[model samples]
Target: MIGRIRGILVEKTPGQALVECSGLGYEVDIPYTTFFHLPDTGQEVTLHTHFAVREDAQSLFGFASRLDRDLFRLLIKVNGVGPKLAAGILSGLDADQFIRCVEARDVNALVKLPGVGKKTAERLLIDMADRIKQLEGQFVPSAGGGSLPEGAVKPVTGSVSDARDEAESALIALGYKPQEAAKAITRVAEEGMSSEDLIRLALRSMIPTK
Candidate 1:
């Protein structure tokens, strides 16, 4: 189990990052929240990671904090929740937000996340409510405090269309049909929105309050 990684960030996208450590470049699957905190390419970065292995493939999922990584491990244990879905959940909402939703029993918020439906939201509320307690001792960055280290490379800005494309791709990755993803993005999108903003808004549009 590769629990953590510290290396030079080589490349990054909305859903993945490449970090070089010990002459080996590791492609780590990451949530958008982690993506938001990534340092510029060629800078040092570290992530708390979980290595997943199956008969056919191996994948590394990483998070900005130990709490998020631990929470991710708990999420995948829920019935019907797999690694991909668990990653999607963290992508849409960070560990802290998700824990708050569960504590508040906010099914509306949970369902709004990509790949989560009523059933999944209910299951998360029921199952994760207790599991989240295990993450209590780990350090959790405060809201909006998950940025890269001081003096690290500044984040690269993208155009509105790039944001839309990223949001659409994220939605598709979470099992939404491409057409559905496109439609949702189009509905809530505005000029100058970031990919994270577009995705957040699009998700809210899809899952309405009861």
Candidate 2:
């Protein structure tokens, strides 16, 4: 298992990042939540990573935090979930939010995520509710202010529309139909919203939980 990666960020898109370690460029698949936290191209970035191997293919998935990576591992263990769907779930919500939803039995919020239906949501709640307890020590509040660790670089902000495009592409990559992605984007469209904002708002609008 490739547990971590430290490299220069060569390029980044909504769902992928090209990172060069030594002379080789590694393409790392990442959730949108991780993508949102990426530093600008050409900067040194570090990610907690998981390397998955199958007879047909091999892939590396990266996350901004160890908690996110750990939660992803748990998600893939669900009866009906796989790496892609697990990644999609993390793309829609970070580890903390997802854990909160599971703890609260927020099926409505889970169903709002791309590719998750009611049955899947229920499965996630039942299966993940206990698994999330393992992540308690790793949890970090997203809204709590904190200084960047030494050697960490800040992400660059892009235009609002670019953010929208990024968020829409992420939703579509998570298995949403193009039209559905567009409608969701349109519904939450607002001035000055970053891609992260658009994604969070769009999801909240679609999944109103108790």
Candidate 3:
């Protein structure tokens, strides 16, 4: 039931962050998008958080924006997506672009994301489009640099991998074969592009129809 936390950011990684609150340190998993926006270590920061509890495990997931957290919740409802995959998806694709892909039934776009396949992308569009609209109504992006402590290493390679995965999933979701999607994503990745940037580049690589 811990909805938010405000504290000193102590550490950060691709999918994790630690915040010092009330003389205690808490670790939270985060998507790449959140990591990308994080501030330097030792800064005061605030995050919207979701607490997941199970018989054997308790974990916190943080988002820079409420929209990101909402999307994370929605993604976990998909048949094969887990918290890790959901984090990966959100890290790779921004909320606005993801909503557009779903609305357009762009399986190509969906398949381009890491861990998303053709069937999965199709399922997401068919099963989740309406839900996206509902969530969109409540969306508000966070306003400042992300809450990260000082000396956090920039996860550039991680970001690239996230982008490549998303781009591949999107290509498949958009109707390209899985093999094609993989190939396109690989080519885009080779160009030293970010995930969002790779998505754009991969789209251009699609075979142009007469």
Candidate 4:
């Protein structure tokens, strides 16, 4: 099952992280929310994981917490929902935020998530309403608290242009078109904002909560 991993973070992008465990480097697909909490490269980090196996390909998805990982498992079981879409959903909203939206039947918020349309949002509302119950007794990590240890993220060394480019790439990876990603990053672009900061702000601007 590959339930968890604790290793040195080798490299990371918006959609993936390379973790070195023992002598092996495992490439883990992670949502943006999980990416947000990743420590700087060379620091130790841990993630809850779900290993997916198909006839031709295998993948490992990582999450910031067990709750998020469990929620992802339940999400993929929904009709028409797959691992990628589930990752996109978590990229927009972490497990706790997603649960609240589901409980409130907030279709607007759900629809704002990448790759989720109105129909999919409504389906998620009806489908995940009960599925979230499965996570009731499990641990619910505080927002932005897991996957990264304190003091591990240092100021990233890069120019504003580099930060903007990285943020745009991240949004595009989350299913936003190139134009949309560029516009969002432009709107939130500020001096001294690192790539991670720009990405977080750009996502919030695109997916504002009610």
Best by TM-score: 4
lDDT of 4 at 199: 84
Task: Please report how far candidate 1 places residue 120 from its true position, in Å.
Answer: 3.0
Q: Model 3, range 1-210, lDDT digits (tens) per residue?
A: 988888998987556789999999999988756766666678877777889887889889998777777778888888887777787677656566577677777787677666788898888888788788767455333335323322233333334456677666655654557897787777766655665456555654542111
How do the residues 1-210 of candidate 1 rate in per-residue lDDT, one tens digit apiece? Answer: 999999999998778999999999999999876776777789889898999998999999988777778888999999999888899888777666677788889998887776789998999999988888887656434457752222222345455456788889888886678998999999998888888677767765764432
Q: How does model 4 fare in lDDT?
A: 0.83
Please give each candidate's TM-score: 0.79, 0.85, 0.67, 0.88
lDDT agreement with native, every candidate? 0.80, 0.80, 0.69, 0.83
lDDT of 2: 0.80
Weakest lDDT window of 10 consecutive positions for candidate 3:
146-155
Winner of 1 and 3 under TM-score: 1
- Model 4, span 77-133: residue lDDT tens: 999899999999989886767877888888888887878999989999999888789
TM accuracy, model 4? 0.88
Q: Pairs clashing in candidate 4?
A: none
Per-residue lDDT of 78 in model 3:
82
Task: Kindly report the root-mean-square deviation of model 3 from the true structure over all alpha carbons.
Answer: 8.0
Write down the RMSD of candidate 1 (Cα, Å): 4.0
Kindly report which residue stretches of model 2 are placed more than 4 angstroms away from their true locations once superposed: 141-155, 160-166, 192-197, 208-210
